[model samples]
Target: MPKVIAQIYPSLGGTSEMSRHRPIGRDPYAFHTVMHGLRQIAQAMDELGYWGLSHVEHHFHSEGVEVSPDPGLWNLYLGQYTKRLRHGQFGYVLPARDPLRLAEEIAMIDHMLEGRLFVGVARGYQSRWVDVLGQRIGVRASSPGDRAGERRNKELFFEHFRIMKLAWEKDLLQYRSRHYEVPFPFESGIADWPAAGLTREFGVPGEVDDDGALRGVSVVPSPFQDPHPPLFQPFSQSRTTVAWAARNGLIPITTFAPIETAGWFAGLYRDEAARAGRDYALGQNMGLVRSFSIHRSRSAAQDAIERYEMLAWREWYGSFGHLGGFRFPGEEGQVPRPGEDVAARLQQVGLIIGGTVDDVKRQLDVQLSAVPFEYLVWHLPYAVMPLGETLDQLELFAHEVMPEFGMTPPEPPRLRVPESSRERPETRASEG
Candidate 1:
C-alpha cells in the first residue's frame, strides 16, 4: 500500500468573493487561525495513520494566499505537536537561500524530529520570488522566462546542493565550485598556518603537532540519520532535471498533471536509474499529489466541489494557475492559456477528487490503476470550507476511502456531545 500524506496551504482568505484580478487583502488574524488549524489537522493525522504532513514554502504574497515563507519553522512548531506523522516541505526552494545554512537547519530538524523530516528541495519557478531573493542576496534580478536567469538558477541549485551533501558526508565542509569556494583547510584535520590560525582563534578544538599541522576539527552536529535523511525533489516537465534527480537517488514528487504524464515521468526515472546502475523500483521513490474531499452524499459532495472550485478559481487558479502548464502523454505539448474553462480543465485532468465515499474510491482506483506511485499526498483543507468541515472530511476519508487502499486508519477521537444536546432515555421514550 502506498503511504498517504496531507498538505494544507495557509491561505489568508480575502477578496475571494470579489474580482479574481483584484489583489487580496491580508487578515492579521489569519496567522493564528491557520496555525491552529494546522495543529489540529496535524494532530489528527498523527492519530489517524497518515505518513506525513507536507507544506509549501512561499513568500512575498500580497494576494493573501500561501504565506508560509519558512516551512522549516512550521515543521519545527508542528513537530512539537505531532507524534509519528512525518513533516516535509513540499519543498524548500534551493535558489533562494544559502546551501550551508539550509543543510545545517535540515540536519538539526532531523535530530529534532528524530529522523522524521523528509527533505524536499526545488529550484523555484516564480520569477517574483526568485528576483526578490536574488536582489536581497546581491545577485542580479532574473525573470523566469530569461534563459540566462534560468541557467544561473539551475547552476546555483546544483552547486549548492553539492556543497550541502558534502557538509553532511564529511567531518568538515570542503567545497570549491564555480559558484562558491570554501577555504577551510582539512587534511585529516585543518591545515596549519593561515587557515589553522584563524580557525583556532574561533575556539575550534584541534591539536597542533610538532610539524604545526592541525588535526580533527569537524562540522558541528552531524545528521541523526546515517549520511543524511531521504532527499526529495518536486517533479517537473524538464526531462534533464527529472533524469538527474533519478540518477542521483532523490525522490521525485509531482502534482497537477494527468495520470499518464505522472506515469511517463515515473518511467523516465526508472530508465535513468537503470542507466546509472541503480536498481530503481517503479513506485518506491515517487509521490503524486491530488486534491481530495469526501462527504456523505453526492449532493453534499457537489456543493463542496462548487465551493472549492469558486475558492480555488478566485484565489488559487486566478493567481498561479498558469504554472500548471505541464503536458500529459498523448496530448499536444502546448501550454494551455488560462481561460473560463479553468474548472473544467482541472476536472478533466482528475486534479480534484471531491465526491461521496464510493465516488472517491472509484476515482482513486482509476487514478492508481493508470499511474501507480509509492505515495499519495492529498491536497487537503480547502480554505472555502470551515475547519470543522475539513476535519470531518478528513475523518470520513480516513475511515471510508483509506480502507479501499488497504490502509486502516485508526478511529478519530470522538467529540463529546454537549449536555444540552444529550437526550435522556425517558424523554426519548415520551417523544416516541
Candidate 2:
C-alpha cells in the first residue's frame, strides 16, 4: 500500500485564497502578510489525517501571472507552526544561482527537520531569465529541438549538485572546477596580480589558494540529509527533462498532463524506470495532483459545482494565464467533457468531492484505489472562497473524507533553513 501524503501551499492563494489571482494581493507584491490561525489549520489536518504541506519556490511575475515567491520563509514558518507536517520546497531556480549557498541552506533544513525533507530541483520555467541573470540566451527557446535554455539549466543544476554532495560528505572543502577552483587561487598567482585573476572579468572577486594558485572562496555549510535530501524534478512539456530525470535518479512532479492522461504519463515513467533497472512506484516518481473540495451534503456539493461552472472557472481559470482546467462539473466545456455527471467528473480527477460524507466516502475510495498517489495538494482557499469558509471546509474534510485514504497527516515539514539562505531567487513566469 502506498503511504498517503498531502500538502498545503502557503501562498495566500495556496489553499486559503480561492479566486483573487487578478489583482496583487499585495500591491507591489511586497511587505508580505502574516498568516492567521495556523493552529486551527494544523489541528484540522492532523485530526483529519494529512501527510504534509509543501511551500513552493515560484517567482516574480508580471500582471497576468501568479506563483509562489518566498518559499524559504514560508517553509520554515509553516513547518514550525504545525507538528507532524512534513515540509518541502522544489528550491531556488538552479541557474543564475550560487550553488554553495544553496547547499548550505538545504543541509541546515534537513538537519532541523530530523530527516523529514523532500527536495526538488528544476531549471525554472522562464526562458528570459537566462538573459536577465547574465546567461547566454537562445538555447531551446524556439522549439523542443531548440532546448538550449533547458539543457543549460540542467547542466548547471547537475554541476552544482555534484559540489553540493561534496560539501555534505567531506569536511575539507577542496574541489576544482571552472566555477569553484581550489588549491587557493590567491596563493598561486603571486608574481603578477595576486589571487584576483581573470575572474574579475566575470565580476567574481578572485582569491588565492594555499597551493599558490589563483582560486576562489569555498562554499560553506554542507547539507544535513545523509546522501542529501530526496530530489524531485518539475515536469512541463519537456521530453528531454523527463528522459534526463529517468537517467538520473529523480522523482518527478508534473503539470499540464491532465488526469485522463495520467496513466499515459505513468507509462512513460514506468518504461524509463524499467530500462534503468528500477521499478517506478505509483506515487514516488509520478504524482498526480489536482484540486479538491468536500462539502457536507450532496446538495451543497451540487450547488458549489454549479456555482463553480457559472461563476468561478471562466473568470479565474484562464485569468492567471493558464490555458486549461477551466471546465468544472456541469460546466459547459471542461477538458474531459466526457459527460455531465458531476459525480463522474469528481471521480475522474479526484479533485472536487462535493457530496455528503457518505457520498464523499465513496468518491474518496474510488480515487484512492485508482491512483494511490503519494501526495494530494489542495488548492485551498480556491478563488472567491474566503479563508473562514476554507477552514470550515478543511474541518469537514477532516471529519468526513480523510479517513478513507488511511493516512495520519504527518507533522508539517520542519523549519530548518538558516537566516542567511532564507530568501529564494525569483524565477520569472512563462509568457504563454
Which candidate tops TM-score? 1
Candidate 2 positional error at 305, Å = 5.5
Candidate 1: what lDDT?
0.71
Q: Residues 1-432, candidate 2, lDDT per residue (tens digit)? A: 333334333334432232344444453332243254444565455555666555455554333223356555655655666556556665456555666777777777766666566676656555444346535422222223446655665566677666665766664456666555444352353334453444344323344433434444444444555567767675433455666676677766655444445444556766777788887665456665554556656777676665533232334433533434423324355454545453344445555555677876776566556656565555453223445666777777666566555645454333346444554332222322
Model 1 lDDT at residue 234 = 70
Compose the digit string of candidate 1's lDDT tens values, residues 1-432: 678877766665534522453444255555677678888988988887788888877787667567688999988899888777788887888777888888889989988887778888887776667677876554433345577877787787787788788878876455665566554344343344555555555534444433446554345566777778778887455578779888888888876687877778888988998898887777668888777768778777767766655565445655664535435566664445545355556666777786778888898899887777888888764454667877887788787888778864323222234354476665888999
TM-score of 1: 0.82
For candidate 1, the C-alpha RMSD (Å) to the true structure equals: 12.9
Instruction: Tell me the whole-model lDDT of each prediction, alpha carbons only.
Output: 0.71, 0.53
- Steric collisions counted per model: 0, 47
Clash pairs, model 1 backbone: none
- Give candidate 2's whole-model lDDT: 0.53
What does each candidate score in C-alpha RMSD? 12.9, 10.6
